[model samples]
Target: MHDFSWGQLVNPEFYIKLGGIYLVLFIIFAETGLFAGFFLPGDSLLFLSGIYSKELIQEIVFIKSDFLNVLLLSSLVSIVGIIGNEVGYWFGKKSGPYLYNRKDTIIFKKRYLFQAKDFYDKHGGGAIILARFLPILRTFAPIIAGIVQMNKGKYFLYNIIGSIAWSFLLIFSGHYLYKIFLNNLDFDLKKHIEIIVLIMVLVTTGPVLFKLFFKKKEGEDDNSI
Candidate 1:
């Protein structure tokens, strides 16, 4: 089996060449659990990972590959994601007022925390589920929920449901379609991977852009009034 180099893990150009499936789990954990991982790519990673499973077993992991394995991977990813968010929530709860009172820096911003709080207040418990599909919001929602002292039982339920939905929707969808179009597609998939990833990023971020625009328009109307 082909092994990836350590350098590949951090290199943006070769980020996908990290320690196979382990890297996928790490990325999911970091993105959901750690504040520093706010910039990590999530949506495209899930989709591409699912597609790569078709060959990863034969070429990299060196195991028998099948859709069942992909399903297992998705389940593992979702479970890890749930754990990550749970950790985030715990961290937020433990940090408590320290985070609230901290000054903004290049990496840490009070505004982000405030925004997350505002979002949580507006959406209530549902934000935990909805935020899974969002980028920045997803990372901060659980933390905000904890900071606000939302019910643990409710949070857990939402986290589990959201993780399952997000993982299956993106990862499984990619694997399923890859199988269907394995021979039917005429284009060079390898050549278009970059484009495909770019599209996924845009699609995932679309809602955030829409929300910003709507908020701006609302503010304009408020000023006019």
Candidate 2:
């Protein structure tokens, strides 16, 4: 954990730090904002990285580490997150139908796609925001949005709104929380990063597992049907 997190989360050198921000941005885009990015970290990492942004302002970017800067970084994260998701929507539109269902395993686990499709249908465009908070659903949200051929202008509007709310709330929350606790002495970088990483794993993965289980159960019922 010590060597694991670079200046992004804790402390480190120079050049590596520059790459981290872009990487985090890219992941946020690919994961929540993109199709295949469902495997990427969403809320948890957003929160953890949000905290790191505060630290970044204080040290790296030289952007006075104050509440004002907090707002700026938070807004930046949200904007980037939403932008990433929009790009993902395009990607999904380009590729989703061909991958909608498996030929051999039609009934294996169609619940996610079906649910995502329905949600996108009813909500119009706001599903983008809802999906940001839900990792597995985030992956499907944009794809489904595309599949439905949602109005491009409306989709962008909703995506920006959702991304701003979701990204700022979660990441800034993480940033503030980390600030409150870690500011004290006896700092534990490894423990801190480890906890954050663990949280990311759970936030990203736990829902996936639960969805898989429920879908499996649904599959069994369909088999019985």
**Relative to the true structure, how large is the alpha-carbon lDDT of every model?**
0.76, 0.67
lDDT digits (tens) for residues 102-187 of candidate 2: 44375645566666667666886666766778767777777678765677888888888888888778867776777667687556
Every candidate's CA RMSD: 4.6, 5.4
Candidate 2 lDDT at 49 equals: 62
Q: For each candidate, what TM-score against the reference?
A: 0.80, 0.68
**lDDT of candidate 2 at residue 201, scale 0 to 100:** 65
Task: For model 1, name the residue pairs that clash.
Answer: none
Q: Candidate 2 — which residues are off by over 4 angstroms?
A: 1-18, 32-35, 58-61, 95-118, 124-126, 183-190, 203-225
lDDT score of residue 40 within candidate 2: 55
